[model samples]
Target: MARKKRPEGTRRPNGASSIYYSEKDGKWHGWVTVGVRDDGKPDRRHVKRKREAEVIDAVRGLEQQRDSGKVRKPGRAWTVEKWLRHWVENIAAPSVRETTMVGYRSSVYKHLIPGIGAHRLDKLQPEHLETLYARLQKPREQGGKALKAATVHLAHRTANVAFNEAVRRRRMVENPARVAKAPRVEQEDIIPFTREEARGLIDKAAEIRNGARYVVALSVGLRRGEALGLKWSDYAVKWRHGCPKGSTCRSRDASKCDLREGRGTLTIRRAIQQRTWQHGCDPDGSCGHRLGAYCPHRRDGGVVESEVKSRAGRRVIGLPHPVIESLETHRSHQEIDRERAANLWADEGWIFTNRLGRPVHPTEDHRAWKALLRLADVRDARLHDARHTAATFLLELKVPLPAVMELMGWSNAAIAKRYMHTNEEFVTAIAAEIGGHLWAEEDDTDDDDGPATVRLAI
Candidate 1:
C-alpha cells in the first residue's frame, strides 16, 4: 500500500490556497485556484519553494494577481513577435487608417520583431526593452547601419502600444515597454516662403499645368493628398444674390455656379495614399512572398482614398477672393480641357484632373511643383512648404491661434507652432513703425542737439 500522505499543514482559508510539505520533492508547496478554465476546471496556480515561508509568499502573490485581474491566461504563452503580428493584423487593422497601420506594421516587422520578438510576452522585462533600443543605436559594423533616434523612438512607441494592448487582452500582467525609456526625436527644419515669394509664386503658378492646385496649396493650406482627392461635389460656392456693377449673379451656391464669380468653401473629405496589401492565403504570410504586393493572392492595395488624418483635418475652409478667382479660372480651363478630351474625358467630377479628366497622379503633381518653383526663380521648397507659408502668413496677420488652427486643420497648437515661422520682414516692419512713431523721419546724429529724444522710465 502507498505510504499515507502526511496530513496537509493547517488548511488555509479560501483564496489563500493550501500549503503542504511534500516528502518526495522535499519542498514546501502551495496551490491557489486563481481562476476557472473554459472547460469548467479550476485554473490552479502552483508554487514550490525550498522554504515554507517562500512558498506561502509566492501563493500570496498569485492571490493578489488574481484579485487584481492581472494574471496572464493559463497555457497561453505568446511571443513578442506573435502578439505584434496579431495586433497589427487583427486588433489594430480594423480600427486605424491604412497609412497608420502601415507604420505599425513596419515598426513591428523591421525593428521590434528582429530585436526582441523571441521573448515571451508575459516574461518581457524593462531591461530587455532597453537592451534592444541600445543595440538599435549601436553603429553598424558588418553591414547594417545604426537606426536613427527617430526610428528607434518609433519602434519604442509601437512596442509600448502593442504591449498595452496585450495587457488589455490579458496576455501580460503589465506592460514592460512603458517602463523602458524612449529615444529622443529631434525636430525637422521646415522652409516656408516670405510674403513676397508667395505672391511671385502664385503669379508664376498661372504658367503651369494645374497651377490652381498650387494656389490652393499656398492660400488654403490644403495638403497635396487633400487637393488630389478633391471632388467637384465637395465645393460649396456662395454667390452674391445679385451684382451691384451690372454683373449677373452666377448662382446661389457652388453646385449651380458657373465658376465666373464666387467665394465659397472647400471641405476636405479624403486623402489619397498608396497602401500596402497583405497576403490573403495565410495570416502568417508564409506562402513565399515577403511583401504583400508581390503575393499573387493579394486582395486590396495600391492608391486608395482614406479618411483625413484626423477629424480636425476634415474641416471646411472659406476661400480668399484671389483663391476664389483662381479656382474659377481653373474651372473654366478644366472645361476647355474636357471639351478637348471629348470621349476620353472620364468626368469623375474631380476639381483637378488630367487632360483625360482623370485625377492628377501624385508623382505628376510633384513634378509640377518642382517645375513651378524653377520657373518662378524662387528658392526650391517642398510642396508642403506652401502650407507652412500659409500658416506663417496667417500668424503674421495676427490671426488668433485658434482661428489659424482651424484654417490649417491643425490638431494641436504645437503643430501650428512648428509650421509657423517668423520671418525677418515682420520684425523689420515692426521696428520701422516703432522708430517712425518715436522719432522724426531722420536718423539720429551723434550731435547733442538731436530732436526731442523719446526716453523711457527705468
Candidate 2:
C-alpha cells in the first residue's frame, strides 16, 4: 500500500512548523523551531525518519513537549553507564541519605548499568527506557525477575533522578526517563497489630531480654533504625516525685509522701545502619577474600550511627510512665551485662545491645521479635509493623495530627495519611518542645561513641 502523505506543516512558525519528503537521504524530515540564535535567526531541531507518518508523530511529540516546558534541545555524548556511575558517585551521593544512596546504587549497578549502559547518553530515547522497564518485569530465567511494580517504578525514578542531574550538569540536554512510562505501583495495605495483639506482644516482651526496645517501638512510631540507634544519652530523666499510696501516680499535687518520680524524654539524632564494608588493603595484596568484611585491614565501613535523613527525624519524644520504667529496668540489666562482660564489652553506649555490647544486628533483632511473637501467641508481623501499630495507638489516643506527626517523625501529612501506610508507616520537626516548656539541648554527642547521660532539664 502506498504511504499517506503528511501535510507540509501543521503548526505556527514557532511550533513544529514544517515537514517534507527528503530526496537526498530518501527519508522524511521535519524541523521544529526551538529557540533564537545569538544573531536572531530561529534555532531549529531537525527530526528525520524513513516514513512520513513517523516524522509527523515525532514532530507533534516534540511540539507538545516544547509547549509543556519538558522539551530539550537535541543532545550530544557519553555511555549511559558511564554517566550514571558519575552521577551516582559524584553528583547524587553527598546530598542523599545512606539508605537512599544504597537504593540508587542497586538500581544503577544491578539493573540500569547492565541493561542500557552501552547506549550513548545523547542517543538514548524514551523507547529505550520503556523497553528496559518491560524487560525488568520478565521472568528470572530471562535475566530479570517478576518484580513488583513498585520495585520497577523505583528503578524508573532512579533513572529520572540521574538524568535530571545530567541535564543540570549540562552533560545531556534531555531526560529520556521523563518521557518514559514506568510500571504502575500498586499501594499495598498495611496490616498493623490490634490493641489486644499489642498488649500480648508487650506481655511477651517482658520475658525477653531488652524487651523495652519493642515497648518503645510499639508505643512510639520510631523507625527500626532510629530505635536501634538510640543511646543512653538520648534519654533524659525528669524528677516527678509524687504520693506513696500509689506506686504509679500522674497527679501533679505534691501533698503525699513520695520517692523521686521521673519521666524520660528520648531524642532522636541518628539511625543505626548496616553498611557494606570496603577493603582497606590493596586488591593485589596477599589477602584473597571476595567480600570486604573478611579483609583484615577493612577500614572504610561497618555498622554505623547515621544522622536521621530529615529534620523531622531529630526531635524529642516524651515517654510514657510505663515506658520510662521499662527503660530504667532495661538500663539496670545492661549495667549488669557490662559488669559481667568486663573488658570484653565494646562500650558503644547503644541503649540495646548484644552480650558483647555491640549494636544488635537488624536481622538478629527481627529474629528476636519473631520469637517474642510466638511466646506471646500473637499472629505473624514484620518488626516494622510495630511502627504502624504505634501510629494506630496515637490516633486512638486522639493526639493531634501535627503532634502525632512530630511524635512519629514523618516528613509530611500525605505520608501520615498513607494511615500511616496501607504497607508500613509518617514525622514533624517540633523544636525543643516539652510539656509547656523548652525541653531539649543542642546535640554535642559524638556520632560513634554515645556516652554521658545528661539530665532531662525540664
Candidate 3:
C-alpha cells in the first residue's frame, strides 16, 4: 500500500505536540512538551504506542496532564529503591524517633525494596502493590513467605508515605500506593495470670535475686524497659511513723525501715534499651571509662536509657505495700553486694542491674523469669502479661474505667477495656444480677380469697 503523505503547503499544529509513525520499530511515537530546562530548551516526554490510534490517545492524555499542571518534567531516572532510601534518610529519619526509624528502615530495605524496588518510581501501578501484598500473604513453601498482616501493613504505610512525597515534589502525577489494599489486623486476646498464679510467681520471684523486678511489674504494670530503667531517686517513701525527728532517710536503710506500715510511689519517666549505635566509638579511647559513663557505646556492652514508649507511658504509680516491702529488701541486698564488691562496684543507680552494677539484659531477665515460673509451677506466660494481670485485677475490683486507664498508663479507655476479660464466673454473676428480680416469688393468699366473690354486670 502507498504511504499517505501531507500536502506541501500544510503546516504542523503549534504548541509542541506531535504524533508520527516510527519505522524503526514499526510503532507510532508521541511527544509532548512538558516544560523548559535551565538552558531554556524544551523538555519533552516520548511515549510509544503500537498503533497510530493509540499514539493519538497517548498524546491527548499527555496534553491534558500538562495543561492541568500535573505533568512533571522528566529528570534523572528514579527506581523504587533509590526513592525509598532517599525518603527514609532525608525525610523520615529526621522527623521520626530512632526506634520508629529502625522499623521504617527494616520495612523499606528488607521487604519493600526486595519486592518492587526495581520498578520506576513514576511508573509504579496499584496492581504491583496488590501483587506484592498477595505474595506476602502466601506461605514460604509456596514460593512466598507469609508475613504478619501487621508487618505487611507497615510496608504499605511506608510505600504510601514515600509515594505521597513523590507527588508533593511533582516527581509523579499520582501515588499508586494510595489505592493499594492491605490486610486488616485483628486484636489479640489478652492473656493474664490468675490471682493465685500471680501469687505463686511472686513467691518464686522472691526466692531469686531480682525478685522485686517482677513484683513491680505485676503491681504497677510497668513495662520491662521502664522497670529496668528505674533509679533509686525515682522512688519516694512515706514512712508510717514519719522519719524520726531530723534523721536522714537513706536508701541503704530501706530494708531496716518498717515498710509494712509505709506507702511508696514510683515515677516512671524513661526506659532502658539496647540500641545499635551507627557511630561506634570516638577517635579517643575515652568512651565507657567509668560507671554510668556518657559514652555513645557501652564499654562492657550495656543498654542506654531512652524515652518512654509514649507520652502516656510517663506516669506516677502508687506502689502496693508488698511491692514496697520487696523493694526495700532488694535495696538492702543490693547494698550487701556493693559492700562485697567494694571498689569494683559500679553504681549506675539502675534498680535492676547485674552484679557489675550495669543494667540487666532483657534476654537474661527473660531467662530468670522463665526459671521463676518453673519454680513456682505456674503456667507459661509472657513477662508482658504481668501488666495485663494488673489491669485485669484493677477492673475486677470495680475500679472506674478512667482510673484504670490512668493507672495502666493507657491513653484511651478502649485499650483499658480490652484488658478487662470476663471469665465464666464473672459472666454468671452478671447474668444473676440481670435476672434476680424476675425470679422473685410474690405473696398471693389475700388476692386469691378476694377473687372468689362474683361481680354483677352494670
Highest lDDT model number: 1
Better of 1 and 3 by lDDT: 1
Q: What's the lDDT for all of these models?
A: 0.84, 0.80, 0.80
User: What tens digits encode model 2's per-residue C-alpha lDDT throughout 128-170?
Assistant: 9899888878787846558677778888999999998888765
- Per-residue CA lDDT of model 1 for 291-390, tens digit only, reads 7888878878876777888888989889987787788789999999999998999988999888998878787899999999898899988999898888
Error of 1 at 61 (Å): 3.6
Best by TM-score: 1
User: Candidate 2: lDDT over CA atoms?
Assistant: 0.80
| TM-scores of all predicted structures | 0.81, 0.73, 0.71
How much is the lDDT of residue 429 in candidate 2?
17
Each candidate structure's count of clashing pairs? 0, 7, 0
Where does candidate 2 stray beyond 4 Å? 1-75, 140-150, 170-174, 244-261, 279-290, 294-299, 421-458
Instruction: For model 3, name the residue pairs that clash.
Output: none
